[model samples]
Target: MKLLSPKLLLLPMLCWVQQAAAQQTTEALSDVQKIEYASPGVRGMGKPRGIVVEYERLPQFDIDSKSDDPEIGNGSARVRRHNKFSVRALAPIMNKPQTKLILGIDHSFEEFNFENVTPATYSLYNSLEDKNLKSVGLQLAFLHSPNEVNFYLVRAKAELNGDYTRDNINISDYLKTTIDVAYGWKRSPDFAWGIGFQLGYTFGRQRVYPGILYNRTFNDKWGVESIFPANARLRLNVSEKTLLYTGYRIEGASYNLLASNPPLSKFNDIELRRTDFKGLVRLEQEIYDFLWFAVEGGFRQYYRHRVFDDVGSRDYIIKNDLAGAGYIGVEIFAVPPRRFTEGRKNK
Candidate 1:
């Protein structure tokens, strides 16, 4: 199968599963029943209810030099160390017996550096580095559950991303968007599975990437959490207030470029495509009911990093080797308040 074929095939399955599972949930809950609280210490979207800030220290990494463009004249490939930061806020906008709504915003910032550039290409490389990389996005999500065992999810986001160095920034040209829809089934108190596809435009192309979301606990001590083609983790419960995880994830983004300096300015605006695979180990500790801290370190393996001209032609490649890095972050969240119907008690 091709890179995106599986994702296309899974779209239909998502809808089918949503309807079937919801039917089962409705039948199972035919009689009036009280609410059931989720298992303690379950890490999920529902667990983090308010604000999150994450920062990672990216270490220097060696790059495998290969570019079709001869003007670059590269001797060696290396990416200078940099810092990455992101802040996210999520809040419940609406809550009802069978439907829910959430609104969120995620913003990120990073700077880029390419090491060991030949003097001949100095002006070009400097122009690229002078541009600051940033992305800001707003997210709207909806959830529908016929009963406790099954639910449907729909999330949409619009993002503004680019190197903000231009005098006349065309905000419309830099906009990026994504949509994800899925159905989930909770087979047991400790196990759940979901199927869905995330559709978006990246690297100057449109793609439909399908994935499976899953969470399963083998026992009190071991478990797995994963969304295939994106991330997967094996988790260990250390204590009531602590947890450990080892996992790998696929990460990447496409940024609009501004080649404003002389000589390189002839190339016009470019598109920088970056993708990486990371294997990591992380520790999470709770400080209080509303606060938590985490630290993680891992290897970053560059999978794809390339530059494309405005006409959608490949211009350069930034092949990089494996590098080690660390990250520390904090989160402040609220315990979700119980929902009540307008005219009747929740039961």
Candidate 2:
């Protein structure tokens, strides 16, 4: 056989080399020590010492709507409001000299309201309903930071949530679980950064009503489906208290009916998938031994894909593009009285 072109023959090898190099870089960078400056507090404990309370509020407006059909509606005015409050309690689960455990709980609520001025058509319509979504999660983290050889953090979290509508409609209910592990180099105390990996799974059900008229008309034949979801987050730390985070998330689900389904269309069965990319920058300042404050801002982009099945024939139906609103929020931290005293005594 004639020899393959040099470029084509080298393409696969080059790709493999690049991937291996990236993996090696991540592993090599994971163990570098962060620089720490002299401060008036404890120096060695990598654990959150006290209870911290954080509150965030983001009010935003959007000028674009996902619907592309100009007659149905081109642009829509929308507002989103989000609030989060969390309480973190830190204590030594195992009092061994080198290992520590921390626990935290966070509760948040987000609401979306869309107003479509575009004249309604037979093919497209606006719901004019507000969407309110809520999420609550708990986390348990274990940390091991000793001298300068190895630093590791392992954490697990679980979250539950309801649908995002205000029309007395329950679209979906979901539960998510995540586990993350990170290894960092022990160098200094002031600045440190590391690459980490996260794995998550989501289980949920999307409820579809029959004809949108009866409240109790549950369609067993059109029941919701379960899905396996996975996402990843990149973690960066500028200081012990400040963090920068970025992540990509995706959720796959199926719906038996489209939002614009006609009254008599039994062929409304559809499957939906959503993907999102988000970035966040946050700064934390310690106000006192027991209290801290934080500010954060971020943006998100989302994509939605729909597939439909009609009369024993399946086809790609619609693709919607949405740009997520940006948000800024503030957080406050509260430490237990004893932890405060301990820090003060150390200082």
Best by lDDT: 1
| Clash pairs for candidate 1 | none
lDDT of 2 by residue, 127-151 (tens): 2133333445676766555544345
TM-score of each: 0.78, 0.50
What is residue 123's positional error in candidate 2, in angstroms? Answer: 12
Best by TM-score: 1
Candidate 1 regions with alpha-carbon error over 4 angstroms? 1-31, 35-46, 75-77, 165-167, 201-204, 311-347
TM-score: model 2 vs. ground truth: 0.50
lDDT string for model 1 (1-347, tens) is 00111112233123222322222221224368554322111332223335667666666665444444565434343557565667767765774546657687877777657777555355445755634577777877777766556767787777767776457667876777777777777666667787777876422344677778777778878888777767777888887567798997666676776767644466777766666667888887777654677777787766666666662445544332334444333344343222311112322
- Name the weakest run of 10 consecutive residues (lDDT summed) in model 1: 1-10
